[model samples]
Target: MDALLFMIFAAIAVICGINLVVQTHPISSALSLVGVMGALAALYLLLGGEFIAAAQLVVYAGAIMVLFVFVIMLLNAGTEKKLAIRPWGKYLGAPLLLLFFGMMAYVVQRILPESSPVVFGAFQGGTAAEIGRSLFTVYLLPFEVTSVLILIAILGAIVLARKEVD
Candidate 1:
């Protein structure tokens, strides 16, 4: 059951990732990214990383994707212009991508233990309290730096908008 569920979500994640890369429109790509993130959250849940799953849903799928959509809209980013690809690129891209994917799958299968099952209650210690404690104690500086970087991004967006108005 666990393996089946993992396979389903993993397939969803892979499809969404491919969609994200292949989509021409920014909005479409962003939506595909959200799907990828949601699938990853489910995978994390199956792995018993509850806090990490919640964080993935709330932070990446929710807030970060919202921010991305906002930026895309604010900048009026339209569908990407179609550019002519080289003949070899057009002919070989899909085959090369599939070959790379096959190689990666083979490597991952070789690296991971076959008998290790992801049971729901098999792992622990990913609670919000523990995460908060670790973030505040050990990762405080990095967290603060991230906040400052976000502030800068927001400010930069505002400045750009103001310039466009002027």
Candidate 2:
């Protein structure tokens, strides 16, 4: 059951990634990225990383993607102009992608354990309570700093994007 869910989510992520790259419109690409993030969150859930999956969905898929769409809309980005495909890219692209994918599979299979530690329900520390405790105790400063940095970045984006009333 877990394996089947993993495959389904993984396939969704790959398809969304491809769609993100191939889309001409900025909004369409951003939507594809949201799909990718959702698939990744599902995969994280299947791996028993409940907190991580929630964070991925809430942080990446929700907040960050909303920010991206806002930026795209603020900039009024339009559909991308299509360029001529190069012969080499047209001819060798699929072959090269397949070769690299095969190599990655071989290396990952060799490096990883037969029974992966991150399998569903194998990890014990992925609950929200444990992560919250750790964040408050050991990682509090960095977490706070990251939050502040994000706030500043958001402010900077807003300031930069505002139109001057000339």
Q: What's the count of clashing pairs in each model shown?
A: 0, 0
**Candidate 2, overall lDDT?**
0.90
Once fitted onto the true fold, the runs of candidate 2 whose alpha carbons sit more than 4 angstroms away are 85-103, 116-119, 163-166
Cα deviation of 48 in candidate 2 (Å)?
A: 1.1
Lowest summed lDDT across 10 adjacent residues in model 1 is found at 157-166
Backbone steric clashes in candidate 2, count: 0
Tell me the lDDT of model 1 at 165.
62
Model 2 worst lDDT window (10 residues): 113-122
Per-residue lDDT over 29-119 for candidate 2, one digit per residue giving the tens place of the 0 to 100 score = 9999999999999988777789999999999999999989998999999998888889999999989999999999999888884864446
Off-target runs (Cα >4 Å) in candidate 1 are 71-81, 113-115, 164-166
RMSD of each: 3.1, 3.1
Please state the error at residue 87 of candidate 1 in Å: 1.7
